[model samples]
Target: MVNWQFWKRRTPARILRLRPRGELSDAVRVEFPELAPDVRTYLGQAAYLQLGYFETLTRLIRATPDLAEKEALSLAAGAALRKHLALLAEIREEDADPAELMEPFREPLDAFRRATVGARPRETMLTVHITAGLLDDFYLALASGYGERGRRVARILRADNDRRQLAELLTETIRGDEEWRALLSLWARRLVGDTLLVARGALLLDGDGRGEAARAVEPVFTALMAAHARRMDALGLAS
Candidate 1:
């Protein structure tokens, strides 16, 4: 069993380095939180699946826009998360099927499927909005134990060569279009900043520099998200 408790104690060095030009709004601070035991446990799994999603997106960003590939990645991430939910339900003796476990996200999933399959680029951004919104909505329902499999996924997703490719792809993605650049930046900023806390807690898990790797990636994520949010606000994409 992965000792998430062990990793949960190491305050990652990156947290202090994050000096976003503008202060995070009160709402953004509210969106962030200290690593509670429960939150750490949930991220032990969530982080793993997120790694996979990122990997797939990294690859697809370079390949010709293949709707099937995008759909496959979304479904796989959704299924993995559902499995984690089922595991949690079983531990609590609450009978649950993995497929049914994702019921709360059905509408979002539908939106994701639609976006992944032949939706216009603008529609695809909407899908990301739906996906992020749904995750926020049901975040507390996530599972919290035996996150090793998820870690394995993360390991595969974050390989050095892969990450390099990912960085390059993101650079190209930003150059590809105005909307994509904005959306990618906003998403990256939020995810990187937030996930740093996750990595801080996972420092003891591998003790093999996983924490360091996470810290190294944080700035890139933050910059991207910040760029997107700025553009979205400028374009009146935010309400």
Candidate 2:
């Protein structure tokens, strides 16, 4: 049986390897409708992603010295955990086992988590902010394709992530140091590749779906990129 509580471990488990998914370099046009994950894959991956974010933020909260910053990180971590539990409730309502649904997605998504883990506290903090922002936007967009259940999910995803304070903290750091500015600017940009990989991985898009994929992916990702720019601009970092 797969351990549903993989989140409790400090190190990621060595799960079964996943089939290769597209990298950012693939220019993977989403070609939605055809590309969206089925309901099970969607809910499973979405819930697990929130749990990953919560875990990462909670670690940051434990390591930081500043009380005020700890409070801010707690807010983001709390928000992520709430979303995870709520999504689990949603899965139960449909008579599906949440862990079973989430199992198939573990390896790839966990790999994505490891790639985004930053060496420094500040860099990790920014990682949570930037990656969370992008994936939430992408999931909310994908929710539209699911129906009434999807509508319910859109509402949950729309909830205040309580992350504004976190972003404010990062923005202050970026404005104060030119070196931090350059390093984090590049770090934030590099995060996009791994992020988009997980986002695309959550979808049902496969070789069979390739013929019309490009046309469908454009609108959702275009909006995602625009939101991403606003986030960077707000941080006074170039996107």
Winning candidate number (lDDT): 2
Instruction: Give the 10-residue window scoring lowest on summed lDDT in candidate 2.
Output: 15-24
Clash pairs, candidate 2, are 30-217, 31-213, 31-216, 31-217
What's the TM-score of each model vs. the native? 0.29, 0.84
lDDT of 1 by residue, 1-239 (tens): 11123434444321212222221222221212222233333343443334333433444444537664445444544543454443444423323343443343344333333334323433333333323322322232111122443333233322222122223333455667888766755554443333333334333333444565545544434543554455344433442
Query: Stretches of candidate 2 above 4 Å error?
Result: 1-32, 206-211
Runs of candidate 1 exceeding 4 Å displacement: 1-95, 112-167, 176-239
Model 2 misses residue 144 by how many Å?
0.9
The digit string of per-residue lDDT tens for model 2 on 92-168 reads 98899999978866786777778888899989988988898888878876676667787788778888799888988
Cα lDDT computed for each candidate against the true fold? 0.37, 0.75
TM match of model 1 to true structure: 0.29
